[model samples]
Target chain A: MLKKGIKYTVALILLLIVGYNSVYIKKLSEVKAAAATGKFDATLYAQTFWQEKLTPGLAKANNLPELLTLLKSDKENAFKNYSHALGIGNLRYFLIKGIGKITASNENDISVTLLPDSVGQEVKLATEFVYGNAVRDALGILSINDFSNTMDMNNVSAEINKKIRTEIIPPFRAQAKKSDVVAFTGAIELNQVHLRLDEIEVIPVSLNLIQK
Target chain B: MSPKVFVKEEKAQVQPPTLKAPAFSGSYSRYLVKFQSLIALFILCLIISLLSDKFLTVANGWNVMRQISVNICISVGMTLVVLTAGIDLSVGSVLALCGAITAGLLKFGIELPSQDLFIGFTLLGVVLAGLLTGTLLGTFNGWTITRFKVPPFVATLAVLTIARGLTMLYTKGFPISGLGADFAYIGTGWLLGIPVPVWISGIIVGLAVFLTNKTRLGRYIYAIGGNESAARLSGINISKVKTTVYAIAGGLAAIGGIIVTSRLDSAQPNAGISYELDAIAAVVIGGTSLSGGRGSILGTVQGAIIIGVLNNGLVLLNVSPFWQQVVKGMVILLAVIIDKANSKSE
Candidate 1:
């Protein structure tokens, strides 16, 4: 009799789980349907992320000069404090703001010399092609788990990169001259082992020319 | 004393008549249990084929085979471990670590102290490195279990965490990518129009079958699982047999890791997360006794295929991934229940 009771309890629990799963599946299907029909808007999500999260979060970003100093002194601690990774095996992303003059300019990258002109520290602001998960993961605000699948998560990243290309990069490229003092906030990705401290490539979120 | 022995003999003779019916049923149920997984596989395939038009196609058949190849490799090793009444939770973590090591070796060749003796990343070197890493880790698990009297579960569980942590540290929590074409061929390349992984798994299954059926060590493994004290009394080196079994399991897991890494062309530190569960489920669903001394490699192969087909068919039918998890759990439970009923009859 006890065995029968235990079996019944297990069955009941399984049924409850199945029922709960069915509801989750229903909700997921609805989301999938929206995705299929192109109703789920990644561009809109990216826009909201830019205005509400990325721009607002810039104030909390690590200062470039300070971060470089920390990186030089202690690499691991600097990563722990400044960089963000969405999960294990993911590249670490950092949101950084700096006041720098464009020391070198090219079609691809604009080299910036951080203020007080430290000799070996150079930051390259990417003006041509913005790639990778830097902008999406840098602020550590957008989570992949929030999306339905990796494809959707990736779509958000693509949209964010597109936003950087269209709105952020064009104006900065048009008005800015070489050696112009500029204040910039951007996201940079780094592999832990290879620091590449000599040249830090950044995907700019916002860049403005400042009068010295 | 003679009179008492005679009386007992008479009683034993008398018991046969009463025991005859149950004896017949026991043998019948044993046979039923033996073929149970195979029957289930056939039925599952039928159901899936009926449900989806794409299921029975040659292309999809090959696709399913390729998909299950890695699981089959792991499950084959898992079958041996289960037969010895042991479990290796470290297989998944070992896979990740080995994959990372292999990818790292390929991407960044090791520098030897002697300037001229640098060991550049050759395909052979990377493969050996991955296999050696797995074997060493498995040996450690076996050694801990035997030498320290640590339970297999606890020992392997510890190794699981250690290996995964090591993998994270080695890769610095980033994926190692761009393994050259020679290494990629092991996973993605085809032989006679079948995937290379499928070929590798087939060879492993063949070798495992021979090892389990035709070797003295295999017999010892079964014996130890059947009754440890009896086997020990019978002059079996239980420690050696058990250790060897675990090492084989670890090596096979490394092969699975290599295949996964080659297929993706990248070794993610988080590769093979929770893979141990899938492998354990496959072993159980294959009709292997969790208590040990009973199971076959073919059953595990079938079980892995069943899972692969279920996954494929569900996607074809547009079933949600969440529902697939639910269904897989239900199937495993049902298989175990059936196994229990069969064993009870015996």
Candidate 2:
């Protein structure tokens, strides 16, 4: 009699698991179909991410001059408060803005000296080529788990970089001259081990000429 | 409690019959029990070699050994725990925590009480700290079980969550990476043309075999698992032996964590997720009865190799990852069924 009860109990548990999994499997199949056909568009997703999330959130960036001062004094506390990290790795991203005079301009990078406190410390704004996941990761709004695979996540980064290259950098490069005062907001990627306070290389999201 | 009263309580509770040498069966059955897992491993290799050309190469052989090394270390500890009819669900979490702590220490040295005074540990010190963390956690698990009479499963399960939460808190949800070359050498460095992890696991297996076969504590462990009431009547320190076994298991898990961290050059908060399942599978597939007292470290080593080969071969053959999980589960079930049948025949 006990044996019979155990058999029925086991059968019921199996049935419940199967019932729950059926719904899960249906949803999985729908995702599989989209993945199989390459129907999930990462470029469009990135385009929306930029306009909807990043542009409106630019004001949230830490002020470059003030951030540098804090970093010089207390590196650990500064990173604890201002930086963003995703998943389980050693990379930290910072979103920062500063008003500076263009110290030097070139095809590769535009070196700018901050107006008030950071006169000697030059921040390079990449105008010709932009790489890395700075813009995608700096906001900490997009998660790697939300994407189907790493390739999709990488494609988002590529699309974001392409947008900056085409839309943001070209306009700034066309009219801007040497010693021109400009306000720029961008993302910077730093390796925790080799965080250099000397030179900050930024991948610009927006650059506006304040004075010619 | 008196021995007579303890024996009465033990006798009242139903227990599975221990695997004893057959009185009627000849040497053939004895050999089968001894060599079944080995035979299974050999057949698995033969099949994989036939299916994938890459399986027979030296590079691939080393890769398989390297991949199995972490599992082998965890399984060695698991084999000891299972021998006492206990389970440790926290090995995976303990591994992650230990690895995170090790990396955290290596990257940022401990700050002293006095301002501007910091102390950095050498490689040996960092590794010892990792092992100590695992041992302490394991000892706690054992103490909780022995003192409170809590089931090993529940005790370890609680520890699993606690350790994982502690790991995330220490790492602050970020991975610690770029550990110097000196530290990376433990994971990636090759000695005498073999991966370091393989060498480390080999030494562990050898020492475990010696411990189980040659020591009095080993005998006590088996005695407790075979019949606790009988062991108590024999005046064996069951609690001490059980706790020691668990501590050993935790230390081995820490070793595994260190290897994994070194190999990846980063200690991720999510490292060793679901690793306990793999270690359990290795122990079970190696012909160790989950009820305890009748398994060997060599069997676990062979079982780990089989699993590693299957993982490597499936990836080589372009099998889907989902299907691989299904196949691995079936293999474990098949192994247990075969073990049951063999023991019944004996």
Candidate 3:
């Protein structure tokens, strides 16, 4: 009689587990389908985000006054102006394109003064923020404002920046030696304003030697 | 206790029919005992799922499985340890030590040519260091316990603090990072779309089930747990079995440690902090008798899944971290209470 009770109990437990798991499975598929469209497509976000937002925003600023004016008055707008495409903190990145004359080279980092073209003002390019989240925060694309309290965004910033440093910077370093006119699209941060605007730094996302 | 000891001493002069039950047989009585934990797990799952839509999702299912893989791996070995009527509190510390050793070696010590490195013996040093450290620690624990006649609890507790100290001294409390993709694949890679840790744990669980079910060592373990003197009288080497069980437990814990370190792309010296308690909880909640020798891998699996599900569900429900702790403790207490009550009734 006890054995019968044990067998029935086991059976019932197994059935309950199976039933619960099936319900969970159903919910999982729905989330997967929804996530397939957005939220989890990290690579998709990374690849297309630059062309859509950063370049246009960077082209809008011609001089230190314009960049600083934007920075001081509406820090959110300043970040939003750059990240308006994905919205603030939507990405840890973006891309901006501009032509600059290389004035100096520091190994992987090169100092380029922007050539007045679209924005119509020459400004020194600062790569001093090269080592950290200066580029991620400058872009204001990472959606960090959304989760400021809950997480340390440093690791994610490091991860995205590390890829940029290793994969994107090497060739640019070799090509943009002093005196080269370079066309580049890259990620920069407006974060550390204690430094002058051009001296602040842009981590180049992509670079091309427009003229040797 | 005194009357029993006196009766046993008196019985030494005359043969007596000793009342003994099979240590871990799926016998009718033992089945009822195992069933109690299973029922707890099922009830927990059902309630948690009903309360949270996110708890029942596929992504969360994988998340839970991945989260529990380390616990499951260590628990298998813990089950064996408990089956021998012994406890191993050092498994967590051993995990940290081995994880630190392996990651430190890979990230800073070992150098491989950049080309075709993935297919090379790139991970050989990491694996060797982890497994070797695990074995040595296990042997040390065993040596301290068996040779000095130290209690298993005391021996393992001492080793626990020792191993943690060793880890901190070795890593200088820094996380070892930049292990690269090839090494990371051990934990983060997928096999047939399942996380690599899950695959590895699944295989280890299968092997553990086989080892405990199909080997002479398994039966001997049961014998030792059921009654030590009887096992010794039957010519089983108590020292050897205990050492082997500890060694297996340590080695499995190392595998778990390595996988976790690889998943995070780094190993923190503080990894596996308090994790031994989790593995013990898995074993206990699975209906393994703390007294010794009456448990199954199946029960522990249920116990692990229950834990994983509970954690995932609580987070999905957006409960406060403090409240989550309270709820988790209450549920764990409830599961064990039910298990104890059912066992007593039986």
Give the number of the best model, judged by DockQ: 3
What is the DockQ score of candidate 1, to 2 decimals?
A: 0.02
Could you tell me which 10 consecutive residues in candidate 3 chain A have the lowest summed lDDT? A85-94
Q: Candidate 1's residue-wise lDDT over B35-105, tens digit each?
A: 88788888888998888888999989988898899999999999999898999999999999999999998
lDDT of 3 by residue, B1-346 (tens): 9999999888865654342334434376656665766666678778888888777788888889999999999999999999989999999999999999887766445333443122112476567669889988988887878899999999999999999999999899888776767888998888898998999889999998898899999899888998999999999999999899999999999998898888877788889987888888888888787778788887888888877777787777777779977876786677678767766866
- Backbone clashes under 3 angstroms, per model: 1, 1, 14
For candidate 2, write residues B89-208 as lDDT tens digits: 999999999999999887665654434445566677688789999999999999998889899999999999999999999999888876778888989999998899999999999999
Off by over 4 Å in 2: A1-212, B1-29
RMSD (CA, Å), candidate 2 to true, equals 22.6
Off by over 4 Å in 3: A1-135, A138-212, B1-33, B110-121
Q: What is the TM-score of chain B alone in each candidate?
A: 0.90, 0.91, 0.86
Q: Give one digit per residue, the lDDT tens place, for model 2 in A144-210.
A: 5686445567788999999999999999999889989999999987766567877788899989999
Error of 3 at B289 (Å): 0.8
Clashing pairs in 2: A89-B175
Please give, for residues A1-212, the per-residue lDDT of candidate 1 as tens digits. Answer: 99999999999998776445322112334444554795457888888888898888999988888988988899999898889978785369999988898888887989888887754477899998898889889888777558744545777889999988988899889888887999999988887766878878989988999953
Superposed by TM-score, candidate 3 places the C-alpha of residue B305 at a distance from the truth, in angstroms, of: 0.7
Cand. 1 Cα-lDDT? 0.86
